[model samples]
Target: MSETSDSRAQRLAAESLAAGSPTAWFETLYDAAGRGAAEIPWDRGAPHPLLAEWLVQHAGEAAGADRTAVVPGTGPGHDAELLAALHFRTTAFDVSPTAIERVRAAHPDSAVDYRVADLFALPPQWRGAFDLVVEVMTVQSMPRTVRAAATAAIRSLVAPRGVLLVIGGVLPADPDPDYGPPWRLTHAEIEAFAADDLALEALDHGPDGLRYRAEFRRSRLLADTTSAIERTPC
Candidate 1:
């Protein structure tokens, strides 16, 4: 019997997870998307509500103009485009070259810079480079062990006094290992970003209770404190 699409995706996800390279399936999915074979479930064709709201609330702020923003794992670039619409210097990257190509093809005149980049191996200059960093549904797609690294990478993109916004699916306090692809993050995992000078400003669950949006801020004082502690010698 032929396998169904859902089953195929599940099998592929399991295989990728077991191989400890969950992002490998993203290339397959993007290739399929390019061929019009599979739809990317999270490509909403518009910015997510949390992102939209953030833009609305912050766009009028004094420093909003000329702000640098990045969207890591930007699959199709809707959120990146939204940032550009607000006049941010936006850079959007995806691990899949095909996905980056599709987004560029879809929006030829877009101001957002769309490129292929692995989160774990981003350019050295990208460290602490953005005034705003948005990660949507990217980290949860990876295997559990990789989530910490991914989260740290996401955290590293925020410059001092900048902000990080995260939107992803979340598990209940107690979660089952087998429940994934949209792997569910635990509260502890979400809170972990607060380490190393970043501060968790807000964490809110979606109305459906299956997803969450977290905001982290990098403050100058916190960065200085961390630097002082590091200099003090353990």
Candidate 2:
């Protein structure tokens, strides 16, 4: 029996994770998708509704020419384009070269700076650099083994007084490693985003408490230099 495209993604992610290369399957997935053998399942073709609502709700706070935003693991850039529309100097990055390439191709006239970047090995200048970080559905897609580090990396992207919004599936119980390329996150895992200088300002649960939209804000009182980077793995 031939594996479906979705199943192929799961298999690729599983194999890469087992081999201790948690993010390597991203390139493989995009490469296959680029070759017309697969689909980017997470690409919603528009900004996520929850994110769109959040932006609308915070229009006063989010709209500004001086503001900067970044969407790490930005798959097809719907969210990035939305942010760019709001006058932010937005940057959307993905670890997969193929994914970035396709995004650039899809939006040749886009104002967004779509580039290739690894969350684990981000440029030093990017730390605490953005005025806003919209991290929807990115961290939860990673395995729990690296979930903490990934959360920290996302948290680190926000500038002092900035916001980090995380949207993802909520794990009702203990995370099962064998279940997903997009492994769901526990309450504790979600709380991890509030670590260090950030505080949980808002949390909204979706139907059956299976989805969540969490907002975290970093303290403006903190200096640019970080006291701790929270490099620990999940």
The numbered model that scores best in lDDT is: 2
Q: What TM-score goes with each of the models?
A: 0.87, 0.90
Off by over 4 Å in 2: 173-175, 220-234
Provide the lDDT at 203 for model 1: 72
lDDT of 2 by residue, 25-50 (tens): 99999999988888887888999877
Model 1 scores a C-alpha lDDT of 0.79
Per-model lDDT: 0.79, 0.83
Q: What are the per-model numbers of colliding residue pairs?
A: 0, 0
Q: What TM-score does candidate 1 reach? A: 0.87
lDDT score, candidate 1, position 141:
80
